[model samples]
Target: MPQETTDEPGVTRPRITPLDIVRTLVLVVALATLGLWGFGSWTMPWNIVIGIGAPVVVLLVWALFLSPRPVLHVHPFLRALVELLIYVGVTLAWWSMGSAWAGIAFAVVAVTSGLLAGRRALT
Candidate 1:
């Protein structure tokens, strides 16, 4: 079983798990992949716009709805939906950039990690 920790005098939180680490790595890779796709697939000015903008936008969305302490308080299911959408968008971006194998591999790992995380969250 996983362990728990006290973050404050009265607040108890679950300890970070292996799944949490995997999920965090997946998010970082997804953001990097988006930036790379933008930089590789566009011209000078447009590349600059997208390469910087894509990750920023994704990061903002994550902060708003998916961060450990999100800006918005939403249902866990809603949070999962948002997270899934980001993953799918990044996977599609990879495929659109002609990295079908990378996209497939990323999707497989992402979905698996997501499902495990979601299961933990739900329980």
Candidate 2:
């Protein structure tokens, strides 16, 4: 997706980069994992609640603080911190479901992508 950058007085849309694609993929994977974790790890009724709720919560948090245009404009460091926390939560969720290697691998990719994206955001 093209993101609007305020390089000039007018709104200029910038071409999406590879990092942007990866970031979007990471987010999709994270939401899917959270949904699966909720359903797979819980009982019937609670599973229904959490399976839907987990992804919704993550989406809200991301929209508020981590999106290209966030509702809450925080410091870049704070934004990164929130992003890291979400990744950590997903990693731990994977580990809890007996997928230690998957969690670690996701952590590696997610953190690397986040760092690169954060660096670009800072610049």
Candidate 3:
């Protein structure tokens, strides 16, 4: 019998690996940040901060897990696009929820995603 070692289909599907999860989480954090600001502007209680901080904490965990250990080589444009989409989607969701300062946080996520774009997709 052979050992059943296998990698997730993230190689092609672009959403099977920890990196993918981290990328998506980046976007979620952007949205959550916006929501947090919105809640704050509305004079909401400090307890509500958790709703926004949750995504950032999750993003950190996923990022630590997603950072390529030895490093993989992915195309620059494709990498940027994937990250951009994730970041935007998450921010947009937050904006839709009527976050007062969500757009500002969205910019931060966009910049972070761009910075992380140097990572290569697993071939």
Strongest candidate by lDDT: 2
Cα deviation of 101, candidate 3, in Å = 1.4
lDDT of 2 by residue, 2-119 (tens): 9885576686677999999999999999999999999999999999899999999999999999998899999888999999999999999999999999999999999999999987
lDDT of 3 by residue, 9-65 (tens): 656533466645655665565656645544544445543665556456545633544
TM-score of 1: 0.86
lDDT of candidate 2?
A: 0.94
Tell me each candidate's TM-score. 0.86, 0.89, 0.37
Question: Sort by lDDT, best first: what order?
Answer: 2, 1, 3
Off by over 4 Å in 3: 1-73, 116-123
Top candidate by TM-score: 2
The reply for model 1, stretches above 4 Å from the true place, is: 1-14
Candidate 1 per-residue C-alpha lDDT over 81-101 given as tens digits, one digit per residue, 9 for 90 to 100: 998899899999999999999
Compute the lDDT of residue 37 as modeled in candidate 1.
88
lDDT of each: 0.91, 0.94, 0.54
